[model samples]
Target: MRLPLGLTAAAILFVLTMVGGAILDQLNENMHVRYRDASVALERLEHASERISGLLREAVLDRNVLLTVGYDNLNRTLDTTLNNLEGLAESFGLSREVNLLGLRRLELQDIERRCLKLMDEDRWGEARDLLFGEDFALSRKLYEIDTENLVSVLDDRLRREATRFATARQASLGVRGLALILLLTSGVLFSRRLTRELAEQKRLQRELTAARDELEDRVRERTRELEHANRQLASLSYMDGLTQVANRRRFDVAYPQEWDRAVRHGYPLALLMVDVDQFKAFNDHYGHQAGDQCLQAVARVLRDSARRSGDIVARYGGEEFAVVLPGLDTRAAVAVAEAMRWAVESMRREHCVSDCADVVTISIGVATRQPKPHQEPAELLAEADKALYRAKSAGRNRVMVWSGEDVSFYI
Candidate 1:
């Protein structure tokens, strides 16, 4: 299941809080360890500095005592103390200031060397002068001051580090306490809210399911009603108003299918383009209402004349009708057109305004071809139109067949 954005954010925040708490605890522990290590180093440094100062005082009190003590022993002690000071400095993490301490140690060694040289020459005065010289006195005083400053610095650093550790520890404790409280509160609230939300989600899901089922039932009922209405609409769209024959649109749609079936069966397809002779004059003289009745009678004749089940009769346009006959050759098409013309002549409807003596007549153009593998529907339509023009020109009230040789007339 996927959580909402708000819930996901809350989960992420909870994880981050836990991670932060753990990091704070680790930092606090590290600070305590560092402070303890620093304190130990500071104490060692202070003790070592005091020992070095005591050795210097002893050397000052009795210059002859250095002979009894042996120069090697004193030098060894000083060297050991210097090494200890270096170690202490390192332990205290004062690597950057180690050089200053080393320089002071070197100065002490140079003083010892000078004292040894004087003792070899047995010149007490020069040795005393060398030990108590202004330069040496100044160097010793500077060394003492440096040691005191080091002690003061170490004390201050220890105090500061202690204060820092205390602050950090206290802060960590406060943060942990607050995080614990927040975690408990958030967990409790989230759990309660999650339960409530789940219940609400369940209720909503049930309502949605019920609504969807009801909607589906209504949709099914509406679908049956629409299907019945559609069947009625289809009938109206295809049937001609006057003759109850197929209309042009329906004929156009059905023609292609029939033509394809004829091609598959290697049969002939024929088309007849029929027009009422002098229809315009008849409409002008007999009135439009009479002309309409005439057109209806003509359509009925065409419908009765097309005998085959595969044949379709349709009103092509004003005073023109088309007949599509599958499995009909040129002879069959001509015979059907002649029969339709006779049917109209038998009507005996008078057209007093028309120059022709006939009551009503029809001019029909017939074209027939056996469907071939690559024959296009356009080619057949063009042939039929050519035949139609020929029928119109050769005097109306006759059937004319398209001849393939008349290229110019067709073009």
Candidate 2:
């Protein structure tokens, strides 16, 4: 009797293993298809990134029309790959990764435009320097490597899920085989064994749920970090690295915005261009190290002097600074310039080689205008520059305001 029961249990176990294997095989095939699709897309994006880099290198190094055309062609291909990546974002439901890719792509486009502009200006060395720069190279590496890793991780996760499913199926088969053996030994034993197997199945389900929840938490945390980094990058872009004030780029952005606002409101807009007196002599006497410190001091004074909500102080290239005054008339803007002069005098940073005085001083040029449809802002800038030149020609430590008349309106 026992021999017959054992034979029956073996027969049932064989059937259970065959069914489990067939189900796992079908699921595994589906997993492979998804993995292949994601990997192929990621690889294509990586290839496009490398091609863009190579094209840029050739265009910059050769400085030929044909190379430039080749570079442009590759840029178009890169744009297409970027679109494909966008589509993949929708397919994978990965909004954060897509957003980062979009940002990187836009930055690359800007770099490309800048390269073209430099080439047009006949600045071959500068254009070559740009492609060899760390910023663009790092940005390309980040986006390509990140996307590739993301695809690999996703594929790995899919593989893991399939493996877990197979493991569970195998475990179930083992339990069923045990139940059959127990039944062959005694009917009561089979019922107890089935009850224990159901409890173990619930335990495994709980483990899987916990793991998925943890993974979701990690994904959300990573998204937050990326957003914070983006904000920081934006802030740094507008700031002057040496002086800690707004840079030329920020001034360019703010100038148009303020001009438009002043035109709409019929308010006065003022611009003050300041030059550190005898800065070249100071640099020559004190050495470059001291020159940097002096500039920082001047920037600090200017920054503190223009403390109003609508006031902007920026480093307008070497040894020159500018203050943007919104909603201020000519007199008010002149007063602001005088205060800035006094602020620099108060710093008392010694410049022995100076023609103006024994200390660091600044000559300021003030220009004010109420915006009109007939006039252009460029005129205001030209007038201010002329006034600055006058201040420098006539003793370097004074303030001169520009009037429509042929001369500077001295203050």
TM-score winner: 2
Model 1, range 1-411, lDDT digits (tens) per residue? 565455566555545654664675566555545544444444444444444444443344334344234446555655565565566566456654555755765786687577657755666667667766886777766766666666666667667766775676566556544544443455554666655644774797699699879978986897798678668766765776766788766777888888899889998999888888899999988888988999999988888888678889988767888899898887777888888877888888886765554588888887889878798876787788778878777767677888575842221
Query: What are the lDDT scores of the predictions, listed in order?
Result: 0.69, 0.77
Runs in model 1 deviating more than 4 A are 1-225, 407-411
* Candidate 1 backbone overlaps, count: 0
| Model 1 lowest lDDT segment of ten | 59-68
Could you give candidate 2's per-residue lDDT for residues 136-191 as a string of tens digits? 78877777676766776576677677778778777866766675565446555455
Which pairs clash (backbone N, Cα, C closer than 3 Å) in model 2?
Answer: none
- Could you tell me every candidate's TM-score relative to the true structure? 0.45, 0.64
